[model samples]
Target: MVEFTDIGDVPSAEVDRMRAVYQPLADSVRELVDATIRTEMDADTVAAVRAEIDAATARLRSRQIDGAFGVRYTTGGDSLAWGNPVIGVRNPIAPPLTIERDLEDARGRVFTDFHLGAAYEGPPGHVHGGVAALILDHVLGEVAAHADTPRFTGTITLRYLRTTRLGRLHAEAAITRTDGIKAYAVGHLADEDGVTVEAEGVFIQPRWARG
Candidate 1:
């Protein structure tokens, strides 16, 4: 069995090069997902496309490592969490989110310019509310995890301000306040028009969590 350790084991220069190569492939796969979900075709045509997609997925799966893509490190000093639900590099299910963290201000932001195909449509032509909430929760959690004070979500509340369209979108979060054991945060999801969903959350450090 090939066991891997920290990414720091990998040389920084090598990691950078690897990322540059892999990122484009990941982006292409994301586009494939969007196209698959939104394609409008007759029954026979759709079936043929599904078969092709299945074959392509199988080919990729043949080269994948078993289980989840856990945090991996190289012999140098590079690290990557390619299976992170919010920012995994190879996960087609998640939007390409290059999360930026402002440790000084305790803020997390992700700007996604991906399309939400029919699979994400809830109403006539709008993105699903639940999906929006999921993205907000993940973004807020990342913000709270900053300061090396990671906490799990204890509660989250979301308000749907407007219908989110299927095109490009932006999401941002910031720490509002922090008590001794609880961190309060607020986030917003917006599009070219304006804010669509606003969220507030309380994250708690578990009893055993080290500060």
Candidate 2:
């Protein structure tokens, strides 16, 4: 598993409490996004629903943060990347990928499984190529973070082997090698049938982010 020694100073109990309070709201928002994309309601009904949504938005806007919710952590060494665009718990536009990492090993391997709905449609019934890249990019980054070595993507190249359908998908990434400050990693995305995308990336430990 990756380490967050330099991040997430909050308490684990507090983090869990916050998630318990907010995850349901986030889930509802995700559902709203899916419904909005697939709704077959009439124009008038849509307008009315839009009005209600606006009202709710206004209510939430009454109290707001001034900036993005960056990565946060707990005293117990847990970090929550909740505002992440691809996996954030508080983000509705995310595929909301749930990642699992190998804590007992240092290979920097990570895996995730998620379902893409109508909100992620492209190429008719298929997922957008860019979306696949997004998922792989994030996973590859994590794969490079194995053994708590924090890094950022320097470059990533992806090849689409086949069209990914709009349903259950799986992805995995692992570090292939490392050279000084550079970590090379490879990953792939697959559906039930087989591989759909392959990616390799060079992750760099930025000077500024290093202790």
Query: CA lDDT, every prediction?
Result: 0.75, 0.86
User: Candidate 2: which stretches are off by over 4 Å?
Assistant: 1-9, 103-106, 146-148
Q: What is the C-alpha RMSD of each candidate to the true structure, in Å?
A: 4.0, 3.2
Cα lDDT tens digits, model 2, 137-170, are 9999988874456788899999999899999999
- Range of the 10 consecutive residues with the lowest summed lDDT in candidate 1: 106-115
**Model 1 agreement with the true structure over 1-211: per-residue lDDT tens digits:** 2234464555787777877887778878778767876678899998998899899879877886677677686665455766665577766666656666654563444334444666567997898898898788988887776434658899999999889997787888888888888888898988889999999999987776564
- Estimate the overall C-alpha local distance difference test score of candidate 1: 0.75
Q: What TM value does model 2 have? A: 0.91
Report the lDDT of model 2 for residue 36: 89
* Model 2 lDDT, full chain set: 0.86
